[model samples]
Target: MSSSGRPPARTRARVVRRMQRAVPALTKTTMARMQAEMDWFEELDAEQRSFVSMVLQAGYSQFIEWYDDARDRETARATPPLSAAVFGTAPQSLTGSITLQQTVQMIRLSIEVAESELAAVVDPDHAAGVQAEILRYGRELAFATADVYAHAAEMRGAWDARLEALVVDSIMRGEADENIRTRASALGWHGTGDVAVIVGPAPSDGSSPEAVVDQVRHAARAAGLEALGAVQGDRLAVVVGGVSDPDKAGAVLAPHFDHGPVVVGPLVDDLLRAHHSAAEAVAGLHAAAGWPTVADTVTSDDLLAERALDGDPAARRTLAETVCAPLNAAGPDLMLTLTSYLDQGGSIEATARVLFVHPNTVRYRLKRVMDVTGLAPADARQAFTLRVAVVLGRLASNQR
Candidate 1:
């Protein structure tokens, strides 16, 4: 009898038979084989066997039949009773039987299993109930995946914004003794230990920033280094410890980043020094090397002068003014004439033709300039110095 009350004899009998037939499949043995395998089965009395068989029939056979009918009804058309949990119907046949229709049906069943088990959870009772439950779960999962994907997207946006800022902070920190020492001491960076800073672009080409960070961390571990990374606005900063040699570190890191450029900063002794060195190196690489908006693997020693030269625009202006004062004071025509003259390998005739002036006028201006700047127009070294001075003078005066 069901909870509503009265024995459904036919349903009961079908359940009972189904359970008996399924027994061999479940146990992987015949009754005789089962008895041989287990001493308990061999010793069972007839009453015991009957009792066990009936119990099995109730749970397996009856339950399965109820499950199958419900499931079939769900498949055929919309129905209400099939939706209830207790009557969740299973398919009528085992999924892997032979026959064209059976094979087709089996494939569909496999899909259902995947959808139910891997993607969403479904009950095995009344088809109507389970189908309703499937819809509910599907809605819930769809909402969940959307929420997760949205959160991941937001994280990526914020990561890009913060990446550059963090890298700047880290590099700046390394240059300062106090910051480097503190951070290094905390991280256990020490003598003969190499520190390297890596700046890379966030994988905007469809790869997850979090996955990239994970890869970087993995690379750091493989290199036996302490590594830290931050993401800011399509940029990634990674600082590593354990290697004193910047070159080796770069080589080790090159293969890890499959996409995007990576610019390496200089290696330093202590944490503080490394921070500064890295910043300088990265800056120099960008400025002197004309590095791409994206770059990888740079060191301090490689770009010290260029980095230093970039320090203060005002200072550079001041220096240029001082160096080129003598050249700038000369008349514009004279300056142009002298430049042409020098460029023409000090040939008076060539200088005159280019400037549309007489050779003697060019010679006269050259003499005056030599007297003023003490630069020998004939000497290559002096000529280079003069050219630089002239260029600097023009720059300082904003004469363009």
Candidate 2:
């Protein structure tokens, strides 16, 4: 009625005094109701319970103090509720311990208790007006609770991403030490099963980086795998856990990448040795350009030839020891026949003529070479791999 938008000073002062007198009793009754009614509240440890009590006390005080000396509805709507002052002063960890829903229940119950406590203090004719304002005040408290929890959640998510990136970077950089192990455990990594690493271009489909990584996690979990991902510059590296089949895990995650070969490393027994897998994946990803038509999702083994040519000693050793050494051990006949076959453009007659043997003899020796090396020198890709292995094997032996 006044330009100050408040009730007459006498009435306003009387009502404010009555509300202030009821707060302590109201807060005590609310706490008692919460402990009896809320299982989560009763289950909190002593420190958290104390934090809750402090917040409850602050809530009631702030609710009373939050009111300007104004009685108009516009003034109540314009009031700043006790979001930060109530919850922010408590430990941030409390935000996680008490969920937003539970916080809502607390707000509702506190208001209910307040309504009853103040009912006897105010005149009966004005009780309805007092209760309406109290409920409006409680509603704003709920909004404040939501804002605090939402901010806590946002902060938590950011901290989680940074920790996850550290774990991935440590493994890729071959530094999976105790510190990284502890950090990965905090990220919920279970060290009980196979692990692998996948490297590819970070997806660029206009999705936020968080959304992309979240989808990768969702997809991996849906496939019964645990995945931790990080977008470092243009590349996305994911460390996958519980992988029974590394390629299957890769297939499940490949669609999340863009414009590059998605290379999966070999499966290792545990996270500690996952650096080996991560290393191979990084090397293969770098050498992927050498294979122009490589599949979208390829294993590091599939890129062995390119990696060997790209001067990865691990790939070179794998090729020479696994393919060339065995062929050489099967004796000179098998070695000579296979080399002549490759050098003479894979023609049986040409190879036999070069080795001075019958065509069937050349064929038989080629079969023996396949047995010794487990690589057929006939298929195009297999032939390329075999050729590189032979070259690398010779270079290695010549140096020796």
Candidate 3:
């Protein structure tokens, strides 16, 4: 063998000539065998099948040229690398139509056909030389195949990120429609369970948007949920699905945000209705700073008092409907008792005196308020929420 990793000129010429003569028949035989062995090949449409045939022919022709070049040191030095040249004749789209495993199987079949045909045609003295070249060429082809798939995977990941951002943005803007659903379908967002939205500051450490999204997705998966995240202005918004508990899901994602309150909206039916949750979460996020002791994962309902004080109309409506309307429906006595109890600084005796009833009666009415509204009067936070609801309810009545 020569230092250039080829047999001496005389022997190299014979082997190259034999390979050139055998390539056409070898390519035909290999394609026929591959079709017979792999059911997937037969399933491809005519256009795709023709494309595969072109790639097989190209691979064979390029291998012969590469082997001939290898025999001549100067030609080998002048030519592009064998791996790059082998796939250059075929379209990159072939990677999409063919799986990597299928591609490998095709390559193996081609090599086998080439070896068998060359062995029969070439001189017995030069068989070893031909076989060695086939092995070297096969290794280079395998590397080229791997590079193709790696590039495809990277392109796919980038496309997915852009699509995910668009979906999340549409949800936040309350513009979700069929187009948004189509995009989410492409992303495989099959969460048919509850969905919630969480809002907080974007990370301040200058991480790329993709990195931030990946971190949130990883955290969500760890907690058994699917998540879509985007950096909208200074805020990081994540819509988590398949979880009934927004607070629990929000806790998993809280660390991905900057140091601040992470507000979670109520759970909704699915991605299409996620806009309502997104709206509530954003409103709560804005109001969250007002409370000094706010929990890291505060629910939008928990922030109703602050949201109402900040003039959020939705919060006002929630207070009026969910809190005041129910109590008012229970009876004027319950409403009057609640108003007196809050106005009198949560004093049962004061409320009883104002209502001209026994203290036990006031306590009973308070329990009735809890039963009607789901808010306990004894808790300070619930007391504040009740007070806001009463004020908003009276104001709404005056306007009507």
Best by TM-score: 2
Off by over 4 Å in 1: 1-192, 256-261, 272-274, 291-296, 312-400
> Model 1 TM-score?
0.34
The sequence of per-residue lDDT tens digits that candidate 1 reaches over residues 4-28 is 3322557544543543464434323
Clashing pairs in 2: none
- Cα error, residue 390 of model 1, in Å, equals 18
lDDT of each: 0.51, 0.84, 0.86
Flag the better candidate by lDDT, 1 or 3: 3
By TM-score, is 1 or 3 better? 3
Q: After superposition, how far is residue 14 of candidate 2 from its true place, in Å?
A: 4.7
What's the lDDT of the predicted structure labeled candidate 1?
Answer: 0.51
Report the candidate with higher lDDT, 1 versus 2. 2
Best by lDDT: 3
Model 2 clashing-pair count: 0
List ranges where model 3 is wrong by over 4 Å: 1-22, 71-78, 81-84, 88-93, 119-128
Q: Which residue pairs clash in candidate 3? A: none
